[model samples]
Target: MQNLTQAIKHLIIINVIMFVAPMLLNMDLTNLFALHFPKNQHFGIWQYVTHMFMHGGFYHILFNMYALWAFGSPLEHMWGRNKFLFFYFSAGIGAGVIYTLVNYYQFNGIYDQLINLGVSAADIQNVLDTGSYNESIITLPNETMREFYSLYHTPAVGASGAIYGILVAFAMQFPNAKLALIFFPVPIAAKYFIPIMIAADLFFGVTKYSVGNIAHFAHIGGAVIGFLIAWYWRKNQFTFR
Candidate 1:
């Protein structure tokens, strides 16, 4: 692997500090930085950007920081530091927006249904406040009720969305580049690997698979924005050198 570029190294350092600071201080940083439902009391405008730097666990940060160094350095080398940072944040913010929009869609479905079934706004607020709802007040099916209950309280965290954007940009810039997967132990070309990963996220997002704690739509959102930016740059023959 190539040595880390200045921007990628700085990002990794910042993320490490963010991850370690909360743990060392015995502080719960999730409520303050993780992206939350807009209606949630913890929701704040700053979280749109901050959430990109927050991770849920050690492995979470490990994978993301590794990807940032592995994939992002090349982009920074090609696009220069300023453009690279712009693309990174743009994709991240775009991911947050799209993730929120999708959450709103699913949330509204349950919200409208609950209202029609005579569930009160106060009761709904209780569920958001405390991830548990009174079954007596909610007439929806058990599964549907659980879905709504989880959606309102769960906050999205981590840099996976922006990392997905980086992966997309990497594939665009080096389609023929060969990459290997640890579990698969097979060297696959970037053109093949990247699309397959995106397709998997799409499938999981639409089907709501048992994949734990992943914001699939956020990955899609980042890729979508990243693709647009990459395509535009490629189309215009944009280059730093």
Candidate 2:
């Protein structure tokens, strides 16, 4: 196991404190720190960065912190603290923006459909605010309406997006490195393993077949942003260390 690099060590500490402090204080910081929809009342600009440090549960934080230490440490070591920190925050902020844009696309699609069906702006806002809509007045599918409501109400919290960025950077740095998943113990090269993971997120994001309250687009966004920046750096032979 590699020793935790400076940036990764500090990041893990901050994430742990964010995760634990709320519980200890019996404080619900979700509204303040978690990433909410742009139209949501609790939405804040800072959430783009803060949400990366907030996690949903024990396993959520565990996996994210472990991945940060495992994948990010090497990147930090190679790029130095300043460059790695910049890339990390850039990818994370990019993830949040992409996630929001995708949600807005879906939400607006449904919203336009409702408007075409004679739903008024007031009624739509009411529905978003209260999660209540008169069935007789709106003939949209239950699943579609449910998704619309959820898009507005659900808040995203986790470092998975940023961790995904690190994973992409790691794979680019060491394509031939062996990697394995807890479920699939067979070791696979990072090049193959990383793409498969990103593909899985894309599939789940598009199909909405994900089992949990996962922000798959955020993962894909992080990977996409990470790839772009990493590719640019490599193409230019950029090195900070």
Candidate 3:
């Protein structure tokens, strides 16, 4: 294993603490620290950053931190500590922003449709608050209701977004680097592997192909920001020093 770069080391430490502390203390920190819909009662401004350090489960944190150590360390070594930290947080926050905006678009569409169908704002608020609706009082299509319900109640947690950013930056800097995934088991150039991952996320996000709360759009958002930053720095001949 490679020795951790300074910023990456601190990040991994924070993430591990965030993951383990709640379990040891017997407190539920996910609801408070995890990113929630801006309109949700539990939503907090600080969660934009905090959510990046929070993970939902053992495998979630393990995968994210592994990616951080494996991919992020080289970038940190290249960009220097401060620049790397800036890039990490910027991509993470940008991901959250994009995710929220996408959710808003979907939520607004559903809200407008419900209102056109004569559903009251109060009824909508009640449904969002209680996670249930009186079907007799607000008769909408079951799928539509479910979508709205899921959007309002689901909280996004994990470092996947920032890790996606790191992955993109790594690919940009070392396009010819060989990467092999456990599932694919074939070594591919960084350029090829990264794009394939992003494309898969795009497909899954559009189709909702899987039933889990994977934030595919957030991953895309991070990749987009990471690419933009890396491209700009390259174009400007920016140096780590």
87-127 in candidate 1: lDDT tens per residue?
Answer: 89999999999999999999999999888878788877776
How do the predictions measure up, each by TM-score?
Answer: 0.95, 0.98, 0.96
**Tens-digit lDDT track for model 2 on 1-241?**
8888888889999999999999999999999999999999999999999999999999999999988888898889889998899899989999999999999999999999999999999999999888888899999999999999999999999988788888999999999999998899999999999999999999999988999999999999999999999999989988775
How high is the lDDT of residue 215 in model 2?
Answer: 97
Displacement of the residue 115 alpha carbon in candidate 1, Å: 0.8
Tell me which residue pairs clash in candidate 2.
Answer: none
In candidate 3, position 93 carries an lDDT of: 92
- What's the distance in Å from true for residue 130, model 3? 2.3
Best of the two (1, 2) by lDDT = 2
For candidate 3, lDDT tens digit of each residue in 1-241?
6678889889999999998989999989877999999888899999999999888889999999999999998888888998898899999998998999999899999999878878889978988777787787677788888889888888899888888988999999999999998898999999999999999999999888956879998999889988888898889978664
Evaluate all candidate structures by whole-model CA lDDT and list the values in order: 0.89, 0.93, 0.89
Residue 28, candidate 3: Cα error in Å is: 0.7
Best by TM-score: 2
Sorted on lDDT, best first, the list reads 2, 1, 3
Pairs in steric clash, model 1: none
